[model samples]
Target chain A: MVHRISLVGETFVFQDLKHILASASLLRSGDELAGIAARDPVERVAAREVLANLPLRHFLTEAIVPYETDEVTRLIMDSHDEAAFTPISHMTVGQFRDWLLSYAADTSSLEKLSPGLTPEMVAAVSKLMRNQDLVSVGRKMRVVSAFRNTQGLPARLGSRLQPNHPTDDPDGISAALLDGLLLGAGDAVLGINPASDHIGRGMDILWRFDDIRQRFDMPVQSCLLTHVTNTITMIEKGAPVDLVFQSIAGSEQANSGFGISLGILSEAWQAARELNRGTVGTNVMYFETGQGSALSSGTHHGVDQQTMEVRAYAVARVYSPLLVNTVVGFIGPEYLYDGKQIIRAGLEDHFCGKLLGLPMGCDVCYTNHAETDQDDMDTLMMLLTAAGVNFLIAVPGGDDVMLSYQSLSYHDILTLRSVFGVRPAPEFEAWLERMALVDGTRLRMNQPYALPNFRAGS
Target chain B: MSQLAQDPWGPLRRYTHARIGLPRTGDSIAGSEVRALQAAHACARRAVHACLDPAKLAVGDSFIEVRSQAKDRSEFVRRPDLGRRLDGPSIALLKQIAPAGPWDVVLVAADGLSAVAVERQAPPLQNAVRAALAHTWRIAPLVVAHNARVALGDEIGALLGVRCVVMMIGERPGLSVSDSLSLYMTWNPHVGRQDSERNCISNIHARGLSTGEGCHKLCWLLKSARKLGYTGVALKDESTNMTLLPETKTP
Candidate 1:
């Protein structure tokens, strides 16, 4: 169905729902590169106006990617909650936006509406909203999930201490992990992006994280960013697989490009939960996503990057993920282009993920070539924190040596915690207190550092 | 880098290349740290936009130069699909230089994201491959693709009707290592093949995967892929456990 709208005496027509979604996106290079962006700024606004009038149920009836071909579309259509949708059943996308902002839609109301909302519906409504609107609404909804400690609590910001090593060196990773842990980070988890694809290396790193957590008796878990299949294989080898991690995308073809499927993820998920490693709760999956991934893999299906990105949240929410992060700038300047575009995509991703009732975090990051710098990251980190982002990925100096990108550093995590008056997850805070790392909720800057067995042991 | 003041955390730099424990003034890293980071970014940014000097790229080497469908660097960065295929003239050039039937493998080098990596690393890797496979396999002429991505190899190989394609391209330039190269090998070389259908060996640099070690794995993969009739997920590089090379630096 071609949607038409006249703006300032010029008529703009979008060929289909996907076209409307694509053209209405906050100007991103990925859409333009996909050749689906609006002809001009006027058409963008025109498309947004058309999208705002469409009822939320229209998304349920019309899928951007056909349900016959894509399992992700099938998941979205088949899993939508009709009962939860009844309150805003008659509302247009614009009305839904107002409802999101209204006093009636608090945390509980948003929770009730979470399963009712599909990615397409949320992506459509987001096009009509600005950065502040996205933040204001997203800040209201809290998506609490847990494993060793609770995440997504209000007035709390969890963080993953990403102690990545270029060569998966035990001493190197141990040193980075030691630094991050000393700064009172890693309340979310201690994760690493191993340089080698060999499962032995991934398993070796996992052992190191597990050993660190066990020896310190810290309220944290361990994860290695390897393939889901590798994690499943590790599980068979009796490796301590705390959270099964994978990079997911919007399309079936894109997921295929990663050599993963819903079935494969399910197998890994089952294997992880069967380990029964959680001390507090049982949310076992951790997923990382980014916009333009589908486009990068040549499986975008003409959908805009942001919409494609929001679709991944639908997939994440299905598995009851403990953590879902969007590596906002890691795809580089090709998709996002500059700091302005990266910042916009970051806010949109966080807001949309929260709306889906998934524990949303942002990898407030940029590539060196992406026309963004540390200052832009600092700005995005501050904004995302205020928007009630569940967590943030904090590497040692925001420089991820293994991944070849800059992310929010461990020091940035300290800044966010201090500036926003937020603390790490409660159980982790208690653990830090026992270690004399905290002085009444504030991290002690001058503590005597002693991890004698860190570099050499286990 | 102030004349009198030095980085207090300098001793901790031994374990990793990651910049950690940077000194902060007021929620921001010190200006010295920022400048150090800027220097790294400057080189990386230059690597992204740097043009491949053909004379320097092919020194005492007869490289059949070609260009991707992307007209220039800007289009090459944005339009990945265009960079994956050859231009009209490039296609014509490849067709003219090749035989009708299949060869064992075709090799193509590309200045992908980092011209420094290609100019510095690809020649030695090419020599190593030629030395390893000259007697065993029917190799095609080395093609130098400008403004290219990994899949450009498939197009050149398909035009030559080769069994496999070895794409040597620049990996994205990181701060610590700007001139790292990557190798991608695909059997049944053709258009529209997924990245999952190929095997990759990235981070070929002085500090990372050594040239000798890279060749060892490549020979093993080429032999296995030919026997197995594929090169992706089904094939795994277990070269580390095998005692083939005299000294192997396990990544």
Candidate 2:
């Protein structure tokens, strides 16, 4: 059976759960819903009624731990006063504590009845220890979502790196030159590791802040922020902007020693929230692709490994959960689609299965130049959409220009008008006056129109 | 100084010249010197074509022949797609030779640049393929392409939709010899792919990596990739020294 446990409440249950809870009489340390609900008589009466009607063990097994199995049957039979175990019997703050205390004392019984109790129970209880942390994360995701929406408008009002020779110029996003093809997409633009030893390079770039301000008209605060050892603290200060560019290749090398570390996401999300409180518009960009770049052909590069595709998939699987965090929207080094059957298979398994529950409005970035065409773009979009990518750094004018560039296709615009009660962008009176419709509904391209900055985040 | 330093491919430009083993034309140089370049080029092309054509070649869209002419005639473009498809006759030939659909993996070799390398390496590669297939593995339809590169295997794999693909391609002919082979592998078929996705087994030749040793390594890689689902960047073959393979003799 697949074991799915939250990381939140694990530690307390494993280490000193019974000891800590007994000493700390206060069940709700700081204003959890259980504490408030306990004080309300009306809610308590309703809960008692439901509990009395419902089978207590059934609810506990389904909600608390699905694999209680034989433990539930054994626990009920062992209890001498089986009538006391009725659902209507209210578990008061004290009674709940006593019951837990009794449960902990019967560890020997638990072990005897359930042979799989020792390590597995420890792991399950350990997972529940992170519940305190989960509450904070849930609240933070909600707040960051609101903040991301609020910062959306004011930030889009200005320009970014200049368009012409945009890739050449480090800061050419604002004054875009020809079209959306300037830097290709966000991932391709920011995913490059041009400077080796990023922390030192970041310091070098930070030192040149005065020169950068003089050279470009960007805001004084619009500096690039990278995740160094002290990145979270740096984000709080609101000086250098943040860019999360961890090397997938480097991480793949680490997989041998460190079996999948999921704590990195919580740490990054916590850090982003801390920084968001101080800074209004976000200057953070995420990049975690290009895991296969480090594989050498024939020559051993010190790492004992099998093939490149394995490393890429390993890296993706490790980082999949972290993608759900609100701070991260950009992802790339999207070289997995390269016509290698093995690598593609791994990508399908890991990416398709593991990556769900992505934060709404997340964008996928492709870092390196795959020279991807329309068909490639379509496949990538379908894959990302399935993986829950709402926003993407699409190839401008590459696929259907209407969907990619204008964010509206003929069918979509018509559907919006008829079904959703929304009109097309060109349907505005001023826009209609300026634009000409050729084929009844579709607007024919006559004069060139500059792309309105559709960057979602601040 | 930085531009000079960054030019990794600079030293290779001088490596380009007419190959050896052709009849004396005495066009550019006197006697033996003129004949040497011609011979080398002829030998290289012959070797490449010999391995590629006989063992089934597929370009982009379909399978091809050792010495087939394009009906469209404009197919000699530098781009990937133009030279991918094979003519009807070559496709018919491939259909006869190619195994049925949904193979676990396929092995393909291409002339790429030097046919001499293909000729020299084909026997060892065949030996390796036999050794791998001896395990009763479900093998895919292997095909050859005319002009190719390392990631060209990715393109072929993508087009074919095989489970795994390993393409043995000709390395650029060097002064020492023209018959050097490189092996590239991927999990699923991907065409028009890049370097950062797949793994490679390169310099598999009599001089560098013995064909037997290359075969052993490829087998090991194929097994691991199948088990783990992907390979290339994460595979570290630091176990036994490849140079110490019992069958290998230094050229």
Candidate 3:
């Protein structure tokens, strides 16, 4: 009786099997592995040589070895120096794919693979995947856990507080914050664009929010949405800087308009890290971007708005920011003319940012001069909610008096939560529950919520 | 890294209202500079929303207060076209108040973007121009249009049947200066005139081009526009060595 070997059911076949065999010094006389043209002959010779040189336990029974199988397996095994690879090296690509799919189907398996796999490896393997496979891999890697357990890229929402009073008074700002919190907004972060660009005023606002959070034991974090340099000053001055915020543009020139470069952003990030005020781990940066900013600043590099926007995402990824929002319709009529254009841009930005492994959010907003209204925002917000966006801007009454534009209001947040059955971040939800701002799944809007005891004058 | 490092751009900042040479703490701008910018921003927003009190304008009893097609400030901001025409009552009032003749110029004051600019700078600017052209030009009665845009002046001038119209309106608020008035002079002022047919003199705030200097520039531009038979790109200001007055900062 003659024993025969066949090459089938292999997940990965090493193309330079002969070279690997040579490197391993595992060849026998009269092998002539390279000249063997016949498929069956090649498989029989390769498998016999590999089986003779390596222990039987090295090869999985389900897989068929077609190349310098032992040498390839050895390389994969040794690759575990950086990250453990013992469990994955013997498995073929098909087997690994099945295992990943099964793990994704049950997130409990996330820890099982966490110790052995790197984000880079997952990113590399993601290229060969399609649809659900890619999505499953992305879902596992996107949630940055530096800030309290975000639980890997779950949908969240936040608001921009334009507590802009005619007079830059603290009482008015505190009122706005209380109003939004009562309405169950600011889950993502409490970001403020101060009416005065003065550092002292910025510091004052930061301190006020910090005091509010401490007094009320609120789970939310705060940021003064000003120039990076100004924010750096606030941080140095012992202000409670949770997230250092800046407006980022795709081109260098536009960033220069905001007085920022990658270096400046890194500096701000370092400052925030040093301050370490956020309850959520040290991922402390908030960035806002618009499409036409680059073109308006004369630094677009002739790229289309969408491409430029994605490039901005690349920049955001470098810092691993806690919040990255794109102010879709806020730029003006020239770039994203109407509701249709604005909606498409918002969806595209969200999709690209998510695809690039960033926690993405949309500003579902429009300027007063834009040929759009609340209905347009409604459509975009619904679509973004369905798309599993991380957050949306929650302004008072959906109108930003300082920016002179309309944005997603506190009411919009309630609508989204009710319609989508989504809640705020875990910590925020717990805080809201404890404060009785929410009853079960519903926001307690009709009930009177207690104001924080910290008075501005006091 | 010295605390005594002299600001390199401090002297240049005195020359312009543009945010320049703001103090830096490390690589970032100082809190004082940031505060100044924020203050400017607040001023600008206030300027935009400020009410235009026609009574406070004090242009004279001969000037009649009128409304544009825009019913309110919100509507004026949303539908700019509505703000460019006179409302029915305003048209009737203009017809009733002004004598229909070939007046040399119709001076119209509008609260465009900044009511503070209209309230603070318009009266002084109008007075200077009026004084400069006292004996030469036959000026029509001033018309103060509420919730009005620049082109509204064209309709008012056409109703008064003037050859030229000088519209002293509020310029858009800048982060540096909010109470800035602008003069838009149009030759052969009438309905259906494009913005290209008008000449603009902007930054006429107390700090910028003063009422006197703006008045001189307007007089020169208006006289040239009248002579050249056009006001826009074809006309230019030829006033020599025009000295800017000391900037009077507005609160």
Q: Pick the candidate with the highest TM-score.
A: 1
Model 2: iRMSD?
A: 24.1
Indicate whether candidate 1 or candidate 2 has the larger lDDT. 1
lDDT of 2 by residue, A1-458 (tens): 12222223331121121122212211211112112212333333332322223322322333121224332222323332334334223543223323323434242332232211221122122122222321222212211111111211111100111121112222322222112212211211212222233444444344343243334222222223234333444444543433433333222224222222325534654565445422233433332322223322221122212122222332333222222111111111121222131223222222211211122222222211122222343343333333323223322211111111111111222222233232221112123333232234332331112222322111
lDDT (tens digit, per residue) of candidate 2 on B70-110: 22211221122334444456546655554456567777766
CAPRI level of candidate 3: incorrect
B-chain TM-score, every candidate?
Answer: 0.89, 0.63, 0.84
| Per-model TM values vs. the true structure | 0.87, 0.30, 0.54
Checking candidate 1 for backbone clashes, the offending pairs are none
Best candidate, DockQ:
1
**Whose lDDT is greatest here?**
1
* lDDT tens digits, residue span B1-251, model 3: 45334543333223322232233343233667556545655677677667788787775576878888878765666456678889998898878766655578878889988888989988777776677787899977777888888999888887877888888888766555678788899987788898878898887876577777778788888778777888887676677645533322332
Docking class of 1: acceptable
lDDT of 1 by residue, B1-251 (tens): 76223643454567777777677665556789889988988899899888777676554567789999889887887778788888899889888877644578977778999988888887777777788888899887777889999988888888888999998888889988888889999999899888889999888888878777777788889999988999998899877643564553322
Q: Candidate 3's residue-wise lDDT over A247-281, tens digit each? A: 88655556777777778888989988887666557
Give the Å shift of residue A343 in candidate 1: 1.4
Pick the winner on TM-score between candidates 1 and 2.
1
